[model samples]
Target: MANALSFTFIHVLCLLLHCSASSAQNVVFQPSFLTIHGPSMTALLYGFSSKITLNLQAIPSSNVTGSFVPPSCVPGVTQWILTSELIAKTAVQVKLRLNRSLRLCGNNETDTDCCVKPLCVLETLQLTACEGNTSQASLIIQVKIYALLGSGNMVFDNSTIIQNQVYRPLGDCPCDLTFNTCDLWCCCDKDCSTADFKLFRYRCLTGPFGGQFPDPEYQCSVQSTQNSPDWFPFLCVTSPPENNPYLGLFYQGNTMAPKPGISFGGSVSLAPALSNAYTEGSPILTIKDQYFTIPQTLNGHCVTNAPVAFLKNLDVRCVTSVQACPTEFPLQTIPEDLRAVVKNGIAVFVGNVVVDVTDQLATELNEFVTSSDIFGSSGLVCENVTLALDYNFHWKENGITGITLTRTVGSVTLKGNVSLTTRYSAMFLSGDIMSEPNSGNPGYQVGRPVIGGILNTSIGNDTVLIARSPMHLWKPVNSGICSSADVRPLLFGENSTSGCLIPVSRQNLTECSLLRNSVHSLQGALIEATLVARNGHPDALTLADWLNITYVTLNSSGVEDSNSSCADIPSHLHIYLWTLVSGFVDGIPQKDIKAVQISYSLSSWRLKCGGGDSAVCMDPAETQLLPITSSVTFIDIPLNTGPPKTRYQINFTEYDCNRNDVCWPELAFPITRFYTGESYSQALAKGLILVFFFIVASVLGNPWRQIRQIWNTI
Candidate 1:
């Protein structure tokens, strides 16, 4: 028996050494001797290899069963100690040698007698071991065997944690997966500091129990109950910690559950639908499964795939590449079925430019493309390249009603691909008026156009009707001067400051007092009217709501002579617009323009009067340049926070648990003892008497029946 046991130990070590030698390149452990079949007590062993050493520690039957121990050898004499030699970096030469005094039941004892003493075991047994450290009993080898005659066998199964294992609280902590980082007020995350917990202003994504079951705080709160406590009935659960309504049974397991998938699965879809109104970060959908995109300038080049935002006005020109011409452009309007509710009509008229849905269907331009009509007469295919496209969306309170697209087609080439300077603009208008644009729905939003009108006192009550336009900012051109070509409108909630140098010749500044007047007129060009909430909805705004300009008067009090150099041209204009937010709709702030304040600055530039050109500065030909710098700053301010509203209300009352069996009127177990008309003492007596009767009857009935059977036999 000793020889056979020694051979079995050598066989297991040889198999492990061979496996380790073959699998040295891979670090992943694959043991050939351990095949975990299932929960059933059967397993197959294979010689698998890994870089780590496996230690086997035997647990005595006395230690496991707490009573049984084989008497074959003395108490402390028989020992199963497994030793190993590290021959390779990835391999271990294991040699398990049991004491020589250890005896086998198969050689000298019957199978039943051996099993009763657990003496006669199989020559070879399957064992599962875990890797542990040197200072501790690292590995525990559990050997399972069945059917001593070899008819059926018990399976052995186990898992190993090499060095360490993290056992957090029982339930799932999905958001608390980051080890040392705070997971946004995750209740189960111990890494979160007090400051991190203070940031939990809203509802907790993971509850206080951290996804654990039998949470009394959340389940038995005041909102969950309908009845009040008895004796003192006005009491309501006020706080989450103190709101514990007693439930009799509370059993929970403390086992960590594993997530089903260990890795990311597939792509997530974030496609937007036309039937729904555009929200934050919503993508613009068009026909042919393409996004309706506009060119955005990035790093001195146009990215043509940038999508246009809904309800926001845009006009941009950039040199971009395009395939073909009019045919390739997104011409098809949004489908009618997918369209949201439209409160206003479809077409909008903008002075000479009539924006209608039918304009997109027009094949030839009236003045631009006159003498052409899809000509194929002389093998000449005049390619109508789309130079510009203007998309005007007519909308009301509901949603966008119709889209009007007017394309500027030019015959650039006969056929192939070409790059052209393409202009694209998207505007949202209400009904048929293009001058009157809807700033927002009910309240103003960031990036929406700011409505303003030129106040004309000549029209009396219709002063807002003279020339209504969205507020515009002077687009800077070469050398910091404003240009008539580029036009940029002011958007709500965007604060910006810009300046440009208007270079004027010294002679021109002296000759033309009209130069300062011209600068004044240029400032007034974009600064048209009083800022309004919305252009379409004309309100009777007070004088305080109207914007007032600053820095118009120059520092030329004593220098009114024609020979005097121009003193202090209007230099800077600061416009401040204040808005008030009352509430939020769909997480978007609802704001109204409250006040408008405008101020300006004036300064003078002194030149060397002794110079050749300075002597004849008043002369028409002396052309030494004098720069008149002017700046415009627009500041938008909103309230710090929206108006506060009540979140939760509580009604407190005195309720005593000692006076009443059930604190609340609702019946609960254990707490609820006596029913109606039943005294406490009477109920207790009746329960005790019933229990005594049952116990007595169970004890006496069995012997009486046996005695009656004996008497009948006699």
Candidate 2:
């Protein structure tokens, strides 16, 4: 059994020895490529067309086999010469000549030719592969290129700090070469304070040449006593891996903290809206896709400047004193009958050009815009813009009152927060290393980039240097401008100025300045009011409004006994009846309305199922209703939030309101006392006479009368 085990072990050892010998022989055949294959083949792009060049480099290979052949020998299977050349458009090729050939290893320490001999020439580059096969070109490398305009490419940083200005050898310099390569140790005297000692310093006296060196080590117990105190200079050298002389000193790892999420840079510019004088067409700015929530001026509550971006092609409006045009009206100050116009106007900062948009364009430009698609690789973040609007105004109901700038725009801090767009294109470095977003300065980048939460056109005026950060992921977002929770009535008198519902002895109808002069018409005080319905639930069927009398709880006895003819009912109930009946003809004989039926809700907008770009539209059913109450202090049917709160329209029309109401009572049918179709009155007298004759005949024994009475009865 022992002999058998020994035989197996001997065979296994022989096999292992054979495998090792074969592996050693594979080295000479497997040559070090020293070629560009994957990552080295980088491309570059420029925003605008410009001339550019790349520095080409080469030196004799430092392989073991390279030294076996003589330097004078041409490159065959052994000796190789690193020759540089430029291929322009593949046809106009040119060779770069060196002043002197560099030595693979120089003999003297101060020999410059051995280190600085490099051939250099600038030439136009083609976006294609090179075709070269010269006698000395033994180590030809392959490179991939894609020079497109604004393509967002990348270039790696490979130049070493130590050799930035200094010349370099063919490869890594050996320790036996020169004092520059060997004297990398650090040492300092013990007298030097630890804080005062520098890790690296540049001095010409102590060092061999005029250059920098690592910190001196104090532990070396030796002294130089010429004039200064005896001091020892010990040694401290860096450990392996980290001690690499080429790149170990100045390398910053690619790492960056995640951003504070995508944010909107605040910017606003009002469109130029000076109008009301000239009767000819002019220039206006065209607005593309962008969301705008425009507020019209009522009393003084809405639509002003928010922080935003610059407008295009705007001509400043002429001053009233300068041009003598229709005086422009400022916002909040409504004229009596509210009538005005805008003439020629000019505004600077928006490129001083005349824009020819419509009157609606200037006033409603905010509402006229929405969001759009992002372009590629250039973080062209969209900014918010608000414009100051100024136009003319005049108002008249029966009398006349006026104020300019009825609905105007001015500078204002925007309300609420803005959000990021939903889609992101291939614009800007994703900052991911070894992945989709590689960290590095983009080669020849352009367009606005979102940095520190703002869109910047350039880094700085003089120093436009750009850098990228290491990638970290918090989350990806694609958001849009959200809707605000605001609704307004926009009804005429019911707006910011005045309305019905003053519980005082004087009716609200007589309160309007336009009507304050005359309280009564020939018949009575014409119930002066502009009835309004909630923008939502205009359907009319049933609603408990801050004004509309729907579902309500009345206080102070739910009834009013002003008229003895009708029964006492809920106070709001009676008002609801009156508020509604005012729109109807004088004597329609309407039934008593006590309460309104509550139906659909209005918390959010109703998205259209079949609509395309119009997916989001206003749906009257989705309303935010006011709670029903009956405090009954002469509740004004017109609740005015003022100016931008709502859009105004004519008072309620009977047909529309009645149609929207689902609970309106049916009319009664008339009843007649007599049946005209049957001639009963005509037959009544004949029947009476016949009855009398029959009675007489019965009394006087007349058979004829008795017969006639019988015939009549028949």
Candidate closest to the true structure, highest lDDT: 1
- Provide C-alpha RMSD values for all models, in order: 32.4, 42.8
Which ten-residue region of model 1 has the weakest summed lDDT? Answer: 345-354
Instruction: State the lDDT of candidate 1 residue by residue for 1-714, as single tens digits.
Output: 665565556555655564454345233222344321111121112222442344333324332223321111111222345444332223333434433222224555555433433232223222322222211111212333221322122232433322211223332454576879988757657788877778883546644345433334333353333442231122233444422332111224233344231111122211122244444234544533355565566676767567656566667767544443345433212323222212121122100111232223334332222122234343224454555668777655534545666666555432233344556778777687652446666677677767676555676754443355566666554234454234467777787666555555555655545766776677666666654543223444443334443323344545443444565456565666766675677998777666665555555544445745455445555444343333333444645645553342122222434455656643332223636457767766776776686666644556666878899999
Q: What is the lDDT of residue 517 in candidate 2?
A: 21
TM-score of each predicted structure versus truth: 0.38, 0.15
How displaced is residue 613 in candidate 1, in Å? 11
Residues 1-714 of candidate 2: C-alpha lDDT, one tens digit per residue? 665555446534533443344234321101111222111221211111112222243323222232211112222231112222221111112122224322322345575434322111112111211112211111122222212112122343444343332222212322223343323322223233444345333321233121233333332222243422222111223344322334422224333343221111122122223222211122222122122112232243333221111111111211111111122332222233222111112221111111111122133323322223223233322222213333211212111111122122322222223221111011111122111121112110111111111112375554322222111111112221112111121111111211122121112222332222221121011111212232212222222211222433322323322211111211121122221222223433221122222221111111232445332223322322111111111122332345542222234333233356642222210112233444665555555776685565455454555877899999
Q: What residue runs in model 2 are displaced by over 4 Å at the alpha carbon?
A: 1-368, 374-399, 406-594, 597-714
CA shift at 41, candidate 2, in angstroms? 87
lDDT of 2 at 608: 33
